[model samples]
Target: MKTPAIAGLILASFALFSPACSQAGINLENTRVVLAAPSKEASLVIKNSATEDLMFQAWIESADKSEDVPFAITPVLKRLAGEQQQVLRILYSGKGLPTDKESLYWLNVREVPQKSREENTLQIAVQQRLKLFYRPAGLPGKVTEAPQQLKWRLLAKDGKPYLEVTNPSAFHLSFAAITLRMGSKGFTAPIDMVAPAATTQVEMAELPNGVQANSLKVELEVIGDFGGILKYDGAISG
Candidate 1:
């Protein structure tokens, strides 16, 4: 992945991470920072899901898009918690990007310390999901058509059977019901939507009973708001 000169500059100023929970309560929910932008730089808005006072640390981590890449975590944000919503921002510097008029980056957020049992579960689940927001670090005023599909293939450590999928649209796709089917077995996509113009390869090793195969048939069926459906299918050999 050779990053363009612009990407080089974008990578330098970029700081990507997930959001923190804002309130302090038994069901303290996470405060999320959503991404949006016109330039190569990306920004997120962190919102609290709880109704009470709260505080916690925050930080970022690189998602395991592939088994070949080692896990990398960003620096931690200390004493960052509140009841109201907050904003966390990141800028991208020069970085390698695909020359095919496409670019990608990983964005994640880890909780400082879940305040309660419920909060702990939320944080843990988010961590396990390995949430990453993909971005298209294109140059200014460049327009590209959104992809009609998103695809992925997963391989087990034993190299027996794995999973593969192709999403039919570039719009935000829900991962809640997205599952990996192997004969009678099934596993869900760890997180939600694969950012537009990006291909997300979710690591299945961390999923329940997910690492015991070499190769297998994989498919993804996603539901849309208009009662429409998106599906992807393919075979992967471990």
Candidate 2:
């Protein structure tokens, strides 16, 4: 156990520069993938921007690795010449996913290690894992409108303030940032994501002073299709 664990740490320490994973030479065309239902298939382009050839592999896995995943990717292993790109076809089974709300998975792409003959050689193979959302057909509101449907409220406990976010829409709501605003002053914090039909309390994003008596205006930076950030406004809920 100790030998393997210690060797893992040493290998990770040398991964200071990301070349094959998500950095300069190799890259994914998009940051996130949205698999809309009724299509059952999606694709991603892996590009080798460096001048040297590289090998890549891709796969889809559950966010929780222990769980069984229902996704498969074609061309799982491929070698791309310099300045070339390859497409990875992602196909989802028709069943085994939530129909009422979006489900989360991870698309993992990694650089395959190459055999090199050199003295004391160490190779860094980094894997890029991105958020993949699978949306079944005929859910609640449109994803564009889901951001506006979020409800928010402020609660003070232990002399600090916390914001409770309730997502009413069936689509999973991803918030990049939250802003608590008084009339003149505002503070912002990063709230990564919130699930559909669920409530989440964001901490460390401190509320503005005088939140107890006043209904603070809340602003959210929501992630939209194409991984773009969009702003939406809502008020404190009761």
Candidate 3:
């Protein structure tokens, strides 16, 4: 069975192969969007980096697959000239969304390129998706501290080793990499995001014949603001 994150990624990959007029060139100013409380709106800057003009569409959807959304994006359709930029305004209606914890959403930007006059030429459109984080005011703790506060444990079930991670805080943690170190040997798990107040178990590779789980040290690199990675270290539970 595939995990939720893995399934979403598969679907996104399938979307890239759909029919399109041509390839588009664009640049997003940020990899993620953060909307804090008390602010009714947020801005995302998108630039058409190619020499030719391009048409684009932008929208927001719940990352959890919910139908009802609490936010709206302005100028859903736009035509930008080469080297031109547009500011996408995201406004929160201040309803139907949680005010106690951070909520996760996805912002999708699709580029529609112009068709070529030459026949037998294929065109491919590009779609970009970024994480959208809605942070409510007065959260118990800071987001920067949430990664280190995660509860970690190593366990064996059905003769297989697994690493369990639990996020107790009300902030979402997006990890870029997770490494498990035991003595001089180390194992790395694929990157994944742990939602606030949720738990995820990552299956580990076969351990050395005599190695034990309890002696391993866990290290994770989380995606931070401005596309940086923040490192955290922890030890497995007894």
In terms of TM-score, which candidate is strongest?
3
* Candidate ranking (TM-score, best to worst): 3, 2, 1
Better of 2 and 3 by TM-score: 3
Query: How far is 235's C-alpha from truth in model 3 (Å)?
Result: 1.5
Better of 1 and 2 by lDDT: 2
Query: Where in model 3 is the C-alpha error above 4 Å?
Result: 1-23
lDDT of 1 by residue, 1-238 (tens): 1111111111011224433333322222222221233343444445545554444333343343332211122223433344465554554443443323322334444333344433212232122112333334342332222222345556554543334444444344554356666668776556465544455555565344544334345565554433345565645543
TM-score of each: 0.38, 0.83, 0.87
Tens digits of per-residue lDDT for model 2, 1-238: 0001111122322334543332336799888898998999988888998777888877777765645778888887798898999988888988898899999888878776565444344666667777889998999669999887887777776767777888888887776887877777777755788877888886544555445635578788887767789998887754
Q: What is the lDDT of residue 223 in candidate 2?
A: 79
Tens digits of per-residue lDDT for model 3 on 1-238?
1112221121121233443234467789999999998897988999998888888878887876867778889878899988899999999998887887889988888776466654444555677889989998999988899988998877776767778899999999998899988878779976489888999987787554435657788888999866799999987784
Worst 10 residues of 3 by lDDT: 1-10
Task: Sort by lDDT, best first.
Answer: 3, 2, 1
Name model 2 segments beyond 4 Å from true.
1-24, 115-122, 208-210, 213-215
Off by over 4 Å in 1: 1-38, 49-53, 65-82, 99-106, 114-130, 137-238
Candidate 1 Cα RMSD after full superposition onto the native fold (Å):
13.0
